[model samples]
Target: MTSNTSAAPRAARRRWATLLALFAILLIGAHLRFLSLITWDEPSSRLHPDERFFTDVASMLHVPASFDEYLDSARNPLNPRNYTKNNWYVYGLLPQTLTQYAAVMLSPQQVLPACVNRPEYSDPSITIGQPCQDTSLADYQRKIVNPDLAVPKLVWLQQALNAEGRDLTGYYEIFKVGRTWSALFDLGSLLLVFLIGLRLYGRRAGLLAALLYACAVLPIQLAHFFTVDAATGFFVLAAVYWAVRCAQNGGVISFGMLGLSIGAAMSCRVTLATLGLLGVLAVAVRLLRRDPLPNGQEDTTDRSHTAISSPRQVVTLSLLLAFAGGLALLSFRLLQPDAFRGTSFIDVLPDERFIENIQRISTFVSGEADSPPQQQWAGRTPFLFPLQNILLWGLGLPLGLAALAAWVVAGWQLIRRGNLAHLLPWAWVTFYFAWQGGQFVTTMRYYSSLYGLLCVLAAWGLVVLAAAKHLPATRVRVPSMVAGRGVAAKHLPATRVRVP
Candidate 1:
């Protein structure tokens, strides 16, 4: 009874410690992102031109008048008479449409007033009194902004909102809100990394991983900005965590959670659909290995009779159902014809065309290609970019070097231990690194995910090293000490060598 009472107190203390650690990690991550928000590049002028397009989409979503106009304009191209004439569609319609719908729901009065009074503007070339010219000023603006010639809905939405007397400031605020919400997704990703580390290794590993991830330059940069990368990271981590847990537990709930995580990640960034494949492969591999469970039963052995009817099986079934249901819900975009158009995913798979595109993308990401006639590669090499930036921007050279060394040692130790499961995460890191190396123009931002992963690995390595050093040593006499004492028949004892 006394022992049981003592155990309860210890358990409560551990729970409290875990909660405190989580809160601390979140606080650190928040500070890193908030610092960037205050001091980092501004979107209006400093960010890449593509960022403006996303903002424009966000604005269009906030106003209804803009939505109607955009729809009408989309159906009727700038040069309706000339069927061959090119009309660039500058923004993604879905994101913008959803944003506008959400804004309208949140603050209808503010959004409606701006949309209702929008100004009457047409393509400049197409005068109101004169016959419509080949193209209008509005069409030219759309074409210039969206040279890709896809998704013109956002431009139309923007024009409509402007016409309705909605100033750019109001639209900007709405965009900011969207960006803020998107950034918060990174916090969720960090939390999953912590939980996964804790489960796989221990509390120390979890705390260290979370701390390193929170302060890591790449995650910090990505999280502070109004981009989809943070969201993508969150889903990727979630999917991996749940999938690993399911593989370990072999329960329906675990599988369901895994599926849901993968589905959500894919929804955030379709490219992450590869992770779903990885998840399935992980489970299949584990089952094939026929590892025994803690209960002594072969993991792959059937127990359909009693086990299937058990409460655990029921819970597992429910989880699987939820996961499948969530995935089905998220995959609704697959039905949309316009999605993935012109991309390799739609046109080819493992074909020459796909390979060539991959090569080109790799080249573009690696900072190896000559800069375009109009643009320059900012002299950022894929491998060196993260190291240099993190040293200069966050930690100093000494600390950065220490971190790198720790990571290298940890990777080597993991390899020595034959911890393939732990090393599996780094496979993606290696792929990204190789992909970036082949690119002609690598950006510091592109290496964010890799850097974040490595930092956690490095922290784990440091923890291991520290533990080994602290282990108590059994003292033993050295032969060298006897040699110095000279031969004395009565005083000298038999020499013994130290066993390290």
Candidate 2:
């Protein structure tokens, strides 16, 4: 009774400690990502080419005036493809769109638009007109110096100002906003990684994994830029987390949520559609193991009932998969509405614009484009170059080695025991590494989505290493007194520790 009473306080203390640890991890991640965000490349251009592209196009985007304008594929400002006359958009539209919208709603500016003076003047380039108002930052009760609210009007006015030949006026503020969003997304991934680890392994693994991710070089670097990599990586991890949940809890809601996550991931980057296969694999594993309960019933080898339930289980799995697929398609259409020319899911899947841009990018990367930038990979070996970069620069040597070791261990365990815990991460890391590492354009950002899984695996390896017992002494020497003369040496039994 005394022991039981004391255990409660101990558990409470542990929970508080875990929460405190998680909070510290988040603070560390936030600081790493957000510190010197806009001025990291102070002597050079702060924006990467991709960052420039996303923010440039985002600056041009505006809410459609009408429902018809929203549906118009040719003129929809939200569409990345329509942002340029050549229709040459390759990256996901959702991330930049969200950033720009958030910036419009959240960020403010002091410099008024040129159009404020010339009320009759309009920018022919943008269809959306700026609402001429004499609103100051003080109107919204925010500090005029901080420039916090009245953002939409300010952004529109900035667009108008740009139209008046002040090129990229007030863009630094927008870039800062974009960087803020990127940092937030990365911080979110850190939390998701912790949750995934907690769900899969336990609190120790979760905390360790979160710590590794928070301190990783690649994620921190990516979060500093206004590019879509950080947000895309977040969605990818979200899909994986939901997939694991669906596998554990078989129900309509779980499957639907998983589908939505996959769809959201796809909307971020179409390459992430591959994660849907992970979901399918999870559900298939559950079925093959013959878990009957909706909430993760343990597999049983009771052959007597197998014949009666096998067909039912198959049908149920099929229905769930079908429902999930439909929801995935639906969410994809809704989130990436501009990708579709019509209401059909067919338009989104066979997105010819995306395909063409991808081909063009491939041509550039493969050196077929004959562009000067193509020379970057002139002496680069596909697989080895990427691997070397990831080890030496991206993840750093120690963590990278740990993750690689974890991957090997996971693959071995999957082969030996078919553990889903091993299977899911191993399959993803293997496939992603093979695909991305084989590319001539294998940059570290391309593998950003894999960081979450790698960090988790690294933590797993570290935990395993910590928990391992040291080898026992093979023999021990003991002293014995013989008839008060001298101490005689004797052997004490000690078993040798063996590792299989």
Candidate 3:
């Protein structure tokens, strides 16, 4: 009784210690991301043009008239050049319209007409050496012209700033808030990693996987920046995790969750459509193998190798339920018909310009692009990205070798005792690397998913090595001696049975 009670406390204490270590890793990840947020110099030019658009849409949600105009204006592509060049007119109008609405709600008299007729900021300044410009304008009249126009939203933001007696033009503050929000998303991503790891592998493996994901430098840097990459990555990981879980558990609800996650990931970034293909392949493979369905029905064995149980039937029902729950959110671009020119899926092939862009980026990475672009690789390489990725990204090479070694020694051991569930994770890692090798562009950011998959295999490799290290010599010797004794040993064994 005392031994049992004592053992329980030790186990509990070890569990707590493990939890502390994971929490420490989480804190370190947060610090690394936040440091980048505060110190990193963002290019003064527009950052994440897509996210800027999202903010505009969010702001416009507070006002009705502006939202209607914004939607209507987006639909009329009769003037594409006007739409593209004057995108600011549509984008800027949201903030202004929202501010106007705010001012009316908070302070009415200060409200002015919406500044739809505002002059462009690029209008020639007096500093230009053209004294004869606008000859009808008198000097005193020119001085009275207001250079700054107050949009309604800006006005409300200004008034709010004044109420707090703070400077309204602190660009850094807005950036800081955006950065903080991005970091929070990173934290949420880490939490999801931990949960997935715990569910897929045991607690120790889960913690290790989460640590690897959180501490990965490139993903960390991306998380700090106000970019959609981090958000897209989070959803990608979530979709993969839930899909794997559904596959393992074989449940209708689990599969529904998987679809929802995949849809959300698609909404976040269209590139994640790859996951949809992977999902279909996984389900099809299961059905071909005559695996039990999620509904607990056994697959028909009479079907040929090519025949698969209808995933369409399963997935279609799941999608219907998911959409009924309002979880199937469409992409903003998908809903806005005018901007995308109503191109059908079949028409949206990679264009010549896109191919040229990819080729340019590829050449830049491969040291064959323009000289000016090459200068961007100053000191940050070898340690941070291109160099680190080229070097450490091949860490999987060694792991592949180790896995081969394990296959030789542990073939019987695995057949007898190993969980086949591990194959899914290992296959995913292999597929990721294979995909990376075939891609034209070799940016480190593109390999983030590969990096994650490798970490899991690395952990598996460590476990294999540790088990080999601890193999009992006595067990090996006993088997060897029994083999050497040959035929008569079993018959003679009863003659002298000795206690050690």
Measured by lDDT, the strongest candidate is 2
lDDT of 1 by residue, 1-500 (tens): 99999999998999899889889889988877766562466545526444554554344322222222222331112111111221222222333333344344444233332111111333445322212233535443233221111222344545544345343324455564445545677777678778766654456767887887787666776666555566667766776666656545446666666666665555444445556554553453243232223532212233222122346544554555456555634442331112322122233122232234446544544544544731465654545665576556544464466556755553553344223335335555555566555455555554554554555555555555565455434222211101122211110112112211
| Per-residue lDDT of 355 in model 2 | 68
In model 3, pairs of residues that clash are: 99-152, 99-153
On residues 1-500, what C-alpha lDDT tens digit does candidate 2 reach at each position? Answer: 99999999999999999999999999999889889987888765554888776666665555444444444444455666654433577777678667656654543344433231211112344343333344553243211122212335445654543344232224555666677778999999999999877766567878999999999999999998888888888988887777766666558887887788888888888778788787777676556443333332223234334333377777887788788888888887777766666434354444566567778787775566776656777778888888787777888999999988878876765554344555566687788888778766777788888999888888866665554423234322111111111211111122211111
lDDT: the better of candidates 2 and 3: 2
The order by descending TM-score is 2, 1, 3
- Give the whole-model CA lDDT for all candidates, comma-separated: 0.47, 0.66, 0.43
Task: Give candidate 3 regions above 4 Å deviation.
Answer: 1-19, 42-174, 250-252, 281-390, 393-436, 471-500
Query: Candidate 3, which ten residues in sequence have the lowest lDDT sum?
Result: 487-496
Off by over 4 Å in 1: 35-48, 61-102, 113-170, 288-375, 378-403, 406-415, 472-500
